[model samples]
Target: MRVELDEERRAQLPPTWQRAFDWAEESLGGRVVAWEAQPRWRPACFFELEREGEILPLYWRGARGEWHRNTRPLEREMHVIEVFERNGISVPTRFGLCEDPPGLILSRIPGRFSLDTATDEAHRRKVLDEYLAQLARIHSIPIEEFEAIGYRRPESPEQSCLGETRGFERSYRATKTRPDPMIEFQLGWCHRNVPKDRPELSFVVCDAGQFMFDDEGLTGLLDFELAYIGDYAADLAALRTRDLTEPIGQLGDAMRRYSELSGREIDFGVIDYHTIRFALINPLSVAGMVTDPLPQANYVQYLAWYVCYGRVGLELMAASTAVELDPPSLPEERPSRRSVAHVHLTELLDPAQAGDDGERAYQLDRMQRTAVYLDRADRYGEALESDDLDDVATLLGRRPSTWQEADAALEELVLSSSPERDPEFIRYFHRRLSREEALLYPVLREQQGIAVPPLE
Candidate 1:
């Protein structure tokens, strides 16, 4: 790949498109004949480009806006990919980095980037095995390479657990514009519980189980923006987040296979530590969007799922630590406050009323999610206040008059807590937090998203 640029054409191109024609021609030495914008968040500027009488599927290293403000640029991933490539792992090839805006042009691999395509028993086992093995192989990569790619190594063995914690803090602090006491608490807990024993650092994908597969076999792993040098166990825990949608295989079996491939004993506690740490990131990121309120096309569904994701992570964290939970109390019923026009608009926006299958699903998700939120608000809006007041009063010495007052009081308590002690208080708050999230699950489940309930 050469560093040639057509300033005239580049200026005329769209940022989201990454100026496909000029980019392909300049980066690949090909005349672009066809291309289309693939559906994706941040667009990934993902494209199926045809040039020089062939198809070159591609991805941009950087996204245009704030959708994923924390994405590690493709420019950075280029070096990481080289490290993986040297290690004999499967990944997309970097054609070149664009000179002007510095985007990475990549050659896309074959296969649908999903788990739904695998139909038969053989297909499922083979694909799952390959996926797990690939992850294990990543952990086996020499730790020295991480440094060459700008990844930092922890000074001590035990501190290695804090690797991803740094990234989580960075994201949470940057995205959160207001008070986030639970996130603040979770971050504190992660810091206090750095898992024992220092395992060899591997190039772990902080967000794992995302890859592509064709009819023939598994292709390259996808999205290395979150790749880092840490305990491979971090990679194991990451799969829990994905388990809702693209689960690799049975967790117990996957663990057994991973232990075999890496040739190192696995630590369940370390995995638990990393899993809880990883889960906390969900609430941090989602709470930012939720509080600020994005004008998303499917805002209701987004809010429900966002809240659910946070809830699930907290529940998993509790389970990882062997904390028991009582069933969450049901919300008290009430009358609707929304006008008839509001209800009509919700019905009118149904996917069945308009849009393509994908768009329709998007619309229907929005509608369903909106209905859930509205219905919940109507049923327990007042009760939610009463419950929070009670919980706040229980946590604090007295009840606060306003929701904001209660929030501030709870936050003060969280921030001022002894990081090393108070097991009972921790369990109590964790359950209260889980119950709080339970309020959002019905809508989240109704949206037809994949979910992994607490593992019994």
Candidate 2:
């Protein structure tokens, strides 16, 4: 196959790439017959190089700083992958690297993408199970051997959890373009709930979409840049985040299969928590990415899917007996000046106090400020409630003597605040509601009410 390189893509290539390409051709004894830059979001280009009668896929990234092809860390990782492949582990066939600028040449794996090309539920499950099996094998490798192969683990559990929490916080903080108390609260929750005693760690493929498949149904992992010796749950979490459509039952089945095959009893509880954490991490990370210079439409779609899936994961985690994680206690819930300031305006607009005009006006102003705070916290329900209250206050400010108007206002609030619709919002609206009550009863009642015919 002749690789075609267009002028535009060639122009996009870094100035040092020509030298690197020449080096690769000479070093590998390949004829540079044809090459085209593959479309990708990353700062790398893919090319097809024909060498000694066989065509091969090649990739190269431009060096940003002092790091070059001969750099210790990058070369060390490449060598680790090479070693893994030599040991009969399935990996991409590495031809070699061009030392000048440090580009990699490897034989592309031939298989369809597991995500895009799996045709049926059975096939998808098989692929996912296979992926998990591979992960198990990787994780089962000795920690010392993994470290010898250049995998580095976090120094401490607190450091590892804190690092994960920090990444989530940084992403969310950056994307929303403002500080969020809810996000902070969630981060604190995750940190506090970090599991203890599940210390099994090994090298894991960390990049979001590292697993790739070709037309032939074989899967190969890619992007070992973020590979590290870490908690096994992190990898499972990444897989959950990547494969959002895969049911928790299927994941459990995969764990069973992996354990049976690898002779290691996997902790389903740890994976379950990490999977939910991964889902929660997605919205923040992708949101941050979209704010970058090259905002990708595909990434936006990925973020949307992840957010929806993450919400589902959140509900499932809440329902699951396995997910025992809980957030840290708030600094203060008492009715301090700050807590009072945080009250929603709608709550202040009680119909019982409609006769007290002076108090109503004062409360409305306070509610407006509270709305601002709730909005910052991503507490949309509370924010909207405040807005509704403000609307009622406006109505009352027009005519203070109208008792019917006040009653109508209260009814509107009640109808709008009903748990029948937007159960997720209702939970946030009324934090006292249990998860079971918030999710199940309202849905069941709504369905039941529809099924039973009303008296004419």
Candidate 3:
């Protein structure tokens, strides 16, 4: 019999009952006394509790359901930790996986997760050097164990670099609710310029520069979702993404140290190739959020991040291809049109008023994000829309009143056209994204860039 809870039945429900918390209870073999969501970009559910006599700090290793990222298989991540743990890397000791809620319960590694708290400037520099050493160590791990565990192996050197793209390509096809011209442009460009010359593959964590530390030093290496056997240079190149939030070290200095540690000559061209690949593929992670939002998901916050960093990625991608960047091409700002409700809502956003430290942190996070959008509006407003419509007219030979129409028209043009298959596609998409990025510069975080000369 189908029994739906009415008002009377709902009143009878347990006060402490939550589906996620219930899973945690069963996983821990005790009732969860307290829990809090971890503040991170990725989906994670973290908590601390007592089981019998001992307090256990645990993280639910994977999301509940329906994530669109092209990540390596989750089961592989569990095995990955085991592989590294044997070699004496500092990873969380796994307790066990919950069969129902579907995540690994990891015994938390103790210490501060951020490196910013390290007051000693000398240790900070030493820590960066240690990061490169760790990367070398990870890459040095023999691939035979990974192979034994059925980690996907590439057929050739080209496949080694390009194979990682398959996950994102598959995901974009399945999760994209609308046409994305820029993402299509990147996909097409990648097809045209897959790297042919590459050295031997190694066990590379494609997303490098992620780990936690305490006063003692590198305590816990974290987030290996993109691990695979690929060009080791791609791992070195991926640190550029890390530099956006928390920098590891200077790229050239790290390269030199890496070469010393591994006794392999550094190839800037190969590094640049992987860098361009990073630039092209990164936007797909948040493309769905920007185009069409899912209910209760913070699409607005992610959209701000995408717009800010997506521009930098485009600039670097274009620069890698030796395309000339145009000067700042900004749109005109419109008159103040802040509504009554908008002003009152902005006034009410107070981080201090939040009930707890976590809530305060989250409140501050959204405040900064809200500032980015407000900055975007202050700088460009509806004039940006006009620019997009003009671009659409040029590309499709028809004017579009809204970006949804423009985006669809461009995707139609891109899908049918040979621009994607030809090398000239680089120049074409470069022109589009670079200009768009320029418009968004006002809202972006101030760049503390360490310059590296173009590849030979």
Pick by TM-score: 1 or 3, better one = 1
For all candidates in order, the CA lDDT equals: 0.65, 0.49, 0.64
TM-score of model 2 (CA atoms): 0.57
* Regions of model 3 farther than 4 Å from truth: 1-25, 28-36, 41-46, 64-72, 113-117, 336-338, 357-379, 391-402, 412-456
How many pairs of residues collide in each model?
1, 8, 0
lDDT, candidate 3, 224-319, per-residue tens: 767888788888777766666665545687787889988877887677667767755567677766667665345445564455445555566657
After superposition on all C-alphas, the RMSD of every candidate to the true structure, in Å, is 5.1, 16.9, 6.1
Give lDDT: candidate 1, residue 6: 50
- What is the TM-score (0 to 1) of candidate 3? 0.81
Score every model by TM-score: 0.83, 0.57, 0.81
* Shift in Å, residue 362, candidate 2: 54
Candidate 1: regions farther than 4 A off: 1-15, 18-22, 29-38, 60-72, 98-103, 114-117, 294-306, 352-354, 357-375, 419-456
For model 3, what is the C-alpha lDDT against the true structure? 0.64
Question: What tens-digit string does per-residue lDDT give for candidate 2 at 7-118?
Answer: 5644554566567676876777765544544332333456667766787766554332222344454565577677567545567776676566655556665564545456
Task: Specify the poorest-scoring 10-residue window by lDDT in model 1.
Answer: 1-10
Q: What's the lDDT for residue 117 in model 2?
A: 59
